[model samples]
Target: MNAIELLCKARKAKKEARSEIPLHHALEVRMQERGWKIVYYGDEAGNRKLASVGLSDFSKDIKSFAFRSNTSKVIAIDSRMPAKNRRHALAHEIGHIDLKHDLAHLTSGDEKDAERFARLICTDGTIFKRIAIYLFCILCLGFGIYGSVCIAATDDPNIQQIDVSASPAVNADEVVHFTASGEKYHRPYCSAIKGRSSFATSIEDAEKNGLEPCQMCHPDIN
Candidate 1:
C-alpha cells in the first residue's frame, strides 16, 4: 500500500494532538509515545556535532529533522525557529516517523508525505478526518490478509495429495485450510490436514463455519 494508505490503515503516528495544546507538551507527549527523544543543535547552548546523526545540514538552514541514533528515534528541532515554525517542524518530523520513511535514503515522495502530514496537524484539524483515519485502520487490520510465512505440506497418514491451486486467489502460505468433513480447521502445513482434500479460508471464516482449530497446528493465521 502507499504511504497515505498505510497512515490511514496501519498504526502509524498519533496525529490528534490539538493545535490549541501547548506545542512543547505535545512534542513531549508525542516523543514519549514513540520512545523518541528531542534535542537542540546545542546542549546548554553548545552545538551538538550532528554530522552523522540525522538528515540535518549545518551549512543550510533547516527547520527540523529526524534520525535514528542507536536504538531510539530522535527529532532535532532548530532552536532558532519561531513558535509557528517549531510546531510545523515537530509535526514534520513526526510525519516522517509515522510514514516509516528511510532516513538513510530520503526521497521526494517521503518529503511530500511528511509535508502533507505536517500540514494536516499544523492546521485546525477535524474530528471526522481523524475518525476516518482509524476507521480505515479497523477495516484493514480486522479483515485484510496477513500472510508473511510460507507453509509446506508434509506426508501424513490422515491426508492424501494436496492441491492449493484448486483455490483461486488463495496462497497456501496465508490461509487456514480444512476439509468439509473434518471438525477442525488447520494451518496449511498442519500434519493432520496436510496433503488432504481441503478448502482454504481465513481463521475468522473457519470459526464462522463452526470449525475448531486443529490440535496439531494450533492455527494462528494473523
Candidate 2:
C-alpha cells in the first residue's frame, strides 16, 4: 500500500481497543514495518537542526515537515518536556503522518484525532515488554535525555539491552576512548570500542552523552 493507504490502515486498526502499549512502541511497529527511520533530537538548532523558518504554529503542532525540493524529512520534538508527555507529543505528530494529515489542510479534528491516535497506540497489552523498552528509550530522548539508544541482541531475558548498554563505562583515569570503527557508534549515551573480535565495556564511570538519535527508532519523524 502507499503511505496514505498504510496510514489509513493504522488508523482503522487503532479504533479497536488493544493492550496498553506506549505510543512510541506502536509508532515504531508501524513506521519500521514501512522502512522509515525515527530520529529523536532534544532541540533543533545549528547544523543539526532540520526545521524551516517558514513553519507556522500549525506545522509545529503537526511535528513533521518535509522539504519539497529534496524530499528531506524533519521531525521536530521538544525533548526538554516531560518524558511521558513528550512521548505523547511525538506520537501525535506521527499520527499525522499515519493518518495522512499532510496531504491536505489539517482540520480541527485532525489534531484531536492525532492525539487520540497517540493514546490508542500506547494503550496496554498490545506491545510486548521488550518492545516497551525501546519505547521507553524513545520517550527518554524526547524528555531531553541526550543519549544514543540502540538495540542489541541479548543472552538473558531478564536483562534488557537498554539496561545493559544505556550507560557505557569510562576508565578509572576518566578517559573515554573510541576506536575509529567504534566511533561510528559513538552516541550521546555511550562510548563504544570496536575490536578485531568483540565489543567490551567498563561500566564503572559513565556520563550522559549528547543525543545523536536514530531515524529508525524515533517515531517523531516524517
Candidate 3:
C-alpha cells in the first residue's frame, strides 16, 4: 500500500476501535480487547533488549516489535525508552497489527508505507489536517517531496514550532509547561494552555517524565 492507502486504513481501524481515550491508550485497549498481549522485554525471558524479541541488530534503534503466530499476536516495547517514545513505538507496532501488515512477507515498499503510516497516526494533529498539508506540499513542488514527507511525519520542527513569549513567572525562563491531560509540552506563554490546568517544569524534567511535543507550540520532539 502507498501512504494514502495506509493512512486510510489506519483511520478506519481507529474509528472501529472507538475507545474515547487518547490514541495511544485506545490502541492498547483495542489490542487487549482483541486478546493480543503487550509485554515489555523484562517481562519475558532474557535481559537483552530487542534481541530477545528477534531483532538483535536493531536493539539500539528499534523501540518495539510485533510477533504473530497461528493463534496469537504479541507486541513488545523497549521499556527503557521515555514514556512518550514508548507510546509512539507501541502505536506504530499497533499500526502494523491493525493494518494486518505481514512482517514475514513485507516488501521494501510495504515497509516504507508501514513506517509512514505509523508516523502519521502517532503525530500530534488530526489525520485530515496532516493529509491536507501533505497534499498541498505535493502540489507545491518548490517545497520538495522530502519536505512533504517531513510534514506528514511530523519531523519538521521548524514548521511546527511557534514563537510565543513566556508568561510572567519567577521560573519562566527555566521551565516549560504542559497540560496534565495533554501529551504536548509547551513554552510557558503558549496560548494552547491558556485556560487549561498546566504545570511548569524544566525541559529536562518534562522529558525525563515523558511528555511529548505540542504540534502548535512545538517543544522538542525528542
Best model per lDDT: 3
lDDT of 2 by residue, 178-199 (tens): 2211212132234232211112
Ranking by lDDT: 3, 1, 2
Per-residue lDDT tens digits of candidate 3, residues 1-222?
Answer: 433335445555555555578777777888888887776664335335335445444344566778777765677787777877877788777777666778567667666556655666666545444453454344334322121122211355545632222233334465666543355678756787764444444565556555666767663454
What would the C-alpha RMSD of candidate 2 be, to one decimal place?
A: 18.8
TM-score per candidate: 0.46, 0.37, 0.50
Lowest lDDT 10-residue stretch of candidate 2? 196-205
Clashing pairs for predicted structure model 3, backbone only: none
Stretches of candidate 2 exceeding 4 Å from the true structure:
1-47, 51-70, 126-222
Q: What is the C-alpha lDDT of each candidate?
A: 0.56, 0.41, 0.57
Ranking by TM-score: 3, 1, 2
| Model 1 score (lDDT) | 0.56
Looking at model 1, the pairs that clash are 42-46, 160-195
**Residue 97 in model 2: shift from native, Å?**
1.3
